[model samples]
Target: MLHVNARGMKCPWPALRAARAMREADAILIEADDPIAPSELEALAQQQGWDFAALDACRFSLRRAA
Candidate 1:
């Protein structure tokens, strides 16, 4: 699993980083403080046919659909 720290990061940064890593890995754990992080990431995961789950208020996990 890949780990990405997008905490305190702005929009697109987190999503872009995650998208970059997704090219190499099927699963990733993202940590972000951005309120929209979850929703944005969730949309990306869905678009990629991956699974998205909330780990906490500022943490989430994404994995290839299984």
Candidate 2:
């Protein structure tokens, strides 16, 4: 699994990093301390038609559609 370390990042940064990682991996685990991280990533996943699961309030896993 690809890992995107977005912990402590500000708004948009976590989403940007996750998007970049998606280019190279079908699945990715992202860790972000930002309170908005989950929602932002949920939006991204919807836009991309992917699957999104929150491992925690600050962590998420995104997977591309098969």
Candidate 3:
């Protein structure tokens, strides 16, 4: 598992960082206090065909398919 704290990070940075980390992980857990992070990450996961679940309003988990 990989954990990322993107609480104050904005836009593509969070998503980009998450994507990069996910590339080397089987699963990724991310936390972002910013409102845009959830949706942006969701879209990125969808576009990449990764499995995702929102743990709460500001937390999300994603898993790469093998």
By TM-score, the best candidate is 2
Task: TM-score each candidate.
Answer: 0.92, 0.96, 0.90
- Compose the digit string of candidate 2's lDDT tens values, residues 1-66: 998899889989999999999999999999999988899999999999999999988889999988
Q: How accurate is candidate 2 locally (lDDT)?
A: 0.94
Put the candidates in TM-score order, highest first: 2, 1, 3
* Segments in model 1 whose C-alpha atoms lie over 4 Å from true places: none
Question: What's the CA RMSD for each of the models?
Answer: 0.8, 0.6, 1.1
Sorted on lDDT, highest at the top, how do the candidates line up?
A: 2, 1, 3
Q: What is the lDDT of every predicted structure here?
A: 0.88, 0.94, 0.88
Better of 1 and 2 by lDDT: 2
> After superposition, which runs of candidate 2 have C-alpha atoms over 4 Å from their true positions?
none
Pairs of colliding residues, candidate 3: none
Cα lDDT tens digits for candidate 3, 1-66: 899998888887888889989879989999887778888988999999998889998889989866
Residue pairs whose backbone atoms clash in candidate 1: none
